[model samples]
Target: MLRRSWHHVTRAASGIRWYVHELMGDTAYAKYVARHETLHPGVEPLTERAFWRQRTDEAERAPVARCC
Candidate 1:
């Protein structure tokens, strides 16, 4: 019972961590890489730094008004 309870606690913590990372866009590159691999198997995906720069540039070019 103790081991099972510990396992549940660890799983819950992992889920919460994943949720926070996703909320903060920390998983964007990982998701991008997965999609890129599926869509363009032969091509190399962009580096994380390049990916963020490109994303930032695109956002800047097309500004969106948000109540942030």
Candidate 2:
């Protein structure tokens, strides 16, 4: 019973961690790489630093209004 309870707790924690990472876009680069490989196997995917720099540049070019 104790072992099962611990397993449940760990699983739930993992799920929460995944959710948080996805929500915060922390997994964007990983997802991008997977899709890029599937869709364009021959092309090299952008480096993580370059990917984020491009993202930031695009965002700056078209600023979105947010109520914060």
Candidate 3:
């Protein structure tokens, strides 16, 4: 079942926390988590405010990249 976004941010991180703990024990998943973690250096709780702020910041920065 698909959970609401709020539920995801509030509750899902706990699931991820434990999953990451298990993943950390494995070399491949640990590296994947590390790379994924790097994209957000200080994300916590993943609140709506922070999510929108990051999205807005990315949107503002995107045009300057001039990618095809």
Q: Report RMSD for candidate 2.
A: 2.2
Q: Give the top-scoring candidate (TM-score).
A: 2
lDDT of 3 by residue, 33-67 (tens): 46657986665444455655776797787857556
lDDT, model 1, position 14: 100
Candidates 2 and 3, the one with greater TM-score: 2
Worst 10 residues of 3 by lDDT: 24-33
Query: Residue 8 CA error for candidate 3 (Å)?
Result: 33
Q: After superposition, how far is residue 39 of candidate 2 from its true place, in Å?
A: 1.6
lDDT computed for candidate 1: 0.97
Full-model lDDT for every candidate: 0.97, 0.96, 0.65
| Candidate of highest lDDT | 1
Q: What is the lDDT of candidate 2?
A: 0.96
lDDT of 1 at 64: 77
For residues 1-68, could you state the per-residue lDDT of candidate 2 as single tens digits?
99999999999999999999999999999999999999999999999999999988988999688999
Model 1 quality (TM-score): 0.72
How does each model score on TM-score?
0.72, 0.79, 0.28
In candidate 3, position 61 carries an lDDT of 79
